[model samples]
Target chain A: MAADKVDPIHQFHITKILPINVGHYDVSFTNSSLFMAMTVIAATAFLILATSGRSMVPNRWQLVAEMSYSFVANTLRDAAGKAGMKFFPMVFSLFMFVLVANLLGMIPYFFTITSHIIVTFCLAMLVISTVVIYGIWKHGFHFFGLFVPSGVPAALVPLVTMIEVISFLSRPISLSVRLFANMLAGHITLKVFAGFVVTLSAAGVAGMAGAVLPLAMAVALTALEFLVAFLQAYVFTVLTCMYLNDAIHPGH
Target chain B: MASNVNTTAEVHHGGAEHGGAFPPFDSSTFASQILWLAITFGLFYVLMSKVVLPRIGGILEARHDKIAKDLEEANRLKADSEAAGAAYEKSLAEARKKAQAIASETRSVLNAALDAKRHEAESSLSTKIAAAETAIAGIKAKALAEVDGIAIETAETLVSTLAGESVGRDEVAAAVAAVTAK
Candidate 1:
């Protein structure tokens, strides 16, 4: 069996589709870009087409559309109260994009956009920046008060403040890494198991029988990946809501 | 199928090291990925906030308003029916009172009329009884006078026959008078 020869990480390779050179930057359209566009198109089409009827009693498609909208809206309201709703569009976009991208990645030979740290990091950075900018804009210098724990003794204030600031700043790093690592690990695990099935089945009758175990495992992992896809999207959006809450109401 | 798998595996192995070590770590595609991400996400956000969300919100609002209106209409109708029921009960009570008054009035009038008729019948019966008693007394008195005359004649005849002689008129008349007077 050539199990060791199979490379699971090979699936994440990016290929250039259309090259666009701008003086110093190599901003060529890639497979990741295509899937990202597809995600946007799918999300937009679902929302627009479903709501076309706008019936008081919604159809199945309209129900799905409404559920997605309210899901994010309610999440925002719960996490940050009514004031957090102002960022609904941004949060909704992030959720749908990540959700679709993760699901698309589960398809054989499709690239998982969220698996890339660059993409997830960019999204996380966006959330963190929005929180900081909006917090400062709304609260002025009082935004710094978010670092100081209210009940802490004066002697330990400096230590607690430093730790708080560090934790607050680590929000984006942790958020982006969580989604990226989950996708990357899940996809790699599925690929490794699938590769085992392929290599074993090529070895003859006994090997083909042995391949069944990995095949079953691959199938199960695929199902788990689907769940992780949804869960990660939820986790990402909810964390974004909590961060936005800090922007709206600092120090708590 | 075996060859296909072999070739794919070969390509994967061949591509692993040279193509890029962990494609995400390759800094080359980050710019394009971020660029397209921004573009796509921006467009999605705009469409959501400007069009789709508002439409859904409007539909929900419309349904809520319609339900509230229907509820209000139902409440109003219920109130109207209750008022009508109250009015019907009031009229029924009034009618019953009116009927009772009329019944008592008619009963009193009938009782008065019956009493007057009974009094007239009693007075007429008493007068008729008095007249009948007077007539009966007159008849009895006449019958007694006739019986007395009869007795006196019979006695005179019997006395003359038994003696076998014609008696003198003054003696006979005196004898009849004494017998009748005794």
Candidate 2:
């Protein structure tokens, strides 16, 4: 057994690359920042390259681009109707960033940006804030009616309202934790299985034979993680649309 | 197996010691991560809203309009050709009817002309026949009178020759008449 070994959790560490200080505030560039930029660049390049031709009779790449565009567009339309399309940019960017981050994390050496609670929480905060601010702006005092259930018995109104408020407040927490936990757990499991492969293969030939099982499991988990990557992005975008629907129409 | 267990334990210990209790719980990097997230998200939003989405939307809208316009034009052309075809068919039917009417009228007119000509020829032939019959009757009466004179003369000559003297024409005629009556 070696005293120093590679740690699976260490992949989640954020190290400062360039240090900047302004009045005791640390705003240095880091690996997370780099990946975020890369996500943006990758998304931008993909969209630009795919649509550069803008052919009416779309080629394969254009079809893919159009499919993704219409996918989010249809989801928003279905979840929140046409009014939800106003936030298409925000929702699309969030989905792409998270999706690309999750996929990139599957690479052997790349960091998983969405695995960090800060990133997921920030995204969730943005969604909740938009809902709150827009709801108040659009509905004014009537927005509070969202807490009241119309079919409730008069005696149970307070209890229903309390439950509604609690659920409402928990939206950001659940949204952030859902994505963060899934990514974090998936990445950890993959690393552990991969570690098992490395450890077993380092043993005798018999151990190497056993290592095939963990390697196969890691491979299967990877495939599952790819599906999860896409699913989580879709879930996040769908929930964002639903929340926006609440803002647009602030009643139960 | 013992070595494998030892390495597994060391891996766990190393993960906890070196990578902290949880790498995400490390607070030193939150500010930069959030800041960069905000910046990158804002950039992406701007690019999507201002540049990419509108372009795609415009292309889609353009294609929709083109398809609709092409369909409308095709419908118009089809309708126009159908109308022309109907008009052509109607005119063809009318032409056939007119030709048939002309042919029947011409046949009737030609038949009437032939009937008129035949009637005129028949009337002329009947008049000619009546004239020819009247002439034949006159010729027969004249021939009878001449024969009477010749017979009287011949009888007078014969009587004169037999009696050795000339007889009178009035008497001979009276004698012939009496013998013919008997």
Candidate 3:
């Protein structure tokens, strides 16, 4: 290995393309920020194009937009009922952003913001805080009683409350880590197998034969990763709805 | 699962602990993360509220219209079937009445034929009885005439034998006449 060889993770880092200092923190725009902006622009353009020429019977593009809307609408309705209508905009937007970002990252050399724990954690925190604050606002001080199981014996109320509170706090941790770990591990494994293919191809005929297996595996993993990316986004959005449901109806 | 995740996390932290061997978890990424969240959030909000929701509302309204149209068509078909069924029943009733009228007409004709036949038979029987009575009266008259002739001849024969002489028929007859008169 060369002394100056860069680590793969460092390649993923978002150092400012045009360095700028803001107070003590380095808040200059980076490659990750650029892609995030691009994702927003692309989503806006796609939705506008899809729905601009709305037809009574719907064309192909219109059908796609309608399906995407109804898909999220129905998911929220099923998970949280009529109470979820207020949260529809938030949930639908989250799904589109995550879905678009994950898909865009598949393009070679594009940064995947969702693959970073800090990014995933911030989103998770937003969702968790929304549910907690909304639940309190909607239910007032009585929302604290959500931690206590109604049918339990009085003797065990304290223990059950503690367990419930701990579980409640674990929500953001689990939600954030689930997305982050899947993206990080999948990308790293893909890189490793790609490294294997390169290393073997240089070592003559015998090495080429060995390269065939890892190359096949790499191809398979890439397709699987793409599916995982979409699935993880769906899981994150759906779990957010479930949490929102508890917030709306705290007695349950 | 928890243990496995902890071990992975331990490895990640362990790599950093052993003298900057690996990159430490960067705190600087926080700003970028927040920026990305905000941008994505705004993008999604505008797109959904303006473009997505309205399209969905249109589809729902269209589906509702289609369902209502189908129900109207079904209701019309049902009414038509019921009307057709009623018409068939009326025709069936009319046919049954016509059949009963034809049967009654045939019955009346049969009754008239039977009455006429009965009258002719009674007349023939009465005529035959009258002819038989006339024949019986003629037979009695003939028998009475034969009996008168036979009584006169027998009286004459008897008188002639008893007297041992040829007594004239007129004398015998006269004696018989006198005795009959006394």
Per-candidate interface DockQ score: 0.43, 0.32, 0.17
RMSD of each: 4.7, 4.7, 9.2
Candidate 2: tens digits of C-alpha lDDT, residues B1-182: 65676677657755644544577877767888889999998998899889988988888888889999999999999999999999999999999999999999999999999999999999899899889888888999999888888889889999999998887888999999998779
The residue pairs in collision within model 1 are none
Q: What tens-digit string does per-residue lDDT give for candidate 1 at A12-127?
A: 77777998988778788888888888887877887889989988889999988888878988999999999999898889888888998899888887889899999999999999
Q: Which residue pairs of candidate 2 clash?
A: none
Local accuracy of candidate 3 as per-residue lDDT tens digits, A23-97: 776666777777778878887778778777766667887777777778888888999999888998888888878
When only the first chain is scored, the TM-scores of the models are: 0.94, 0.94, 0.91
Deviation from native of the Cα of residue B10 in model 3, angstroms: 24
Candidate 1 vs candidate 2: the TM-score winner is: 1
User: C-alpha displacement of B69 in model 3, angstroms?
Assistant: 3.3
TM-score of decoy 3: 0.70
The candidate that achieves the highest DockQ relative to the unseen native structure: 1
lDDT of 2 by residue, A71-183 (tens): 88999899888888888888887887788888888788788899999999999999999999989988898888999889889999999999999999999989999999999
Q: Tell me which residue pairs clash in candidate 3.
A: none
Candidate 2 docking category? acceptable
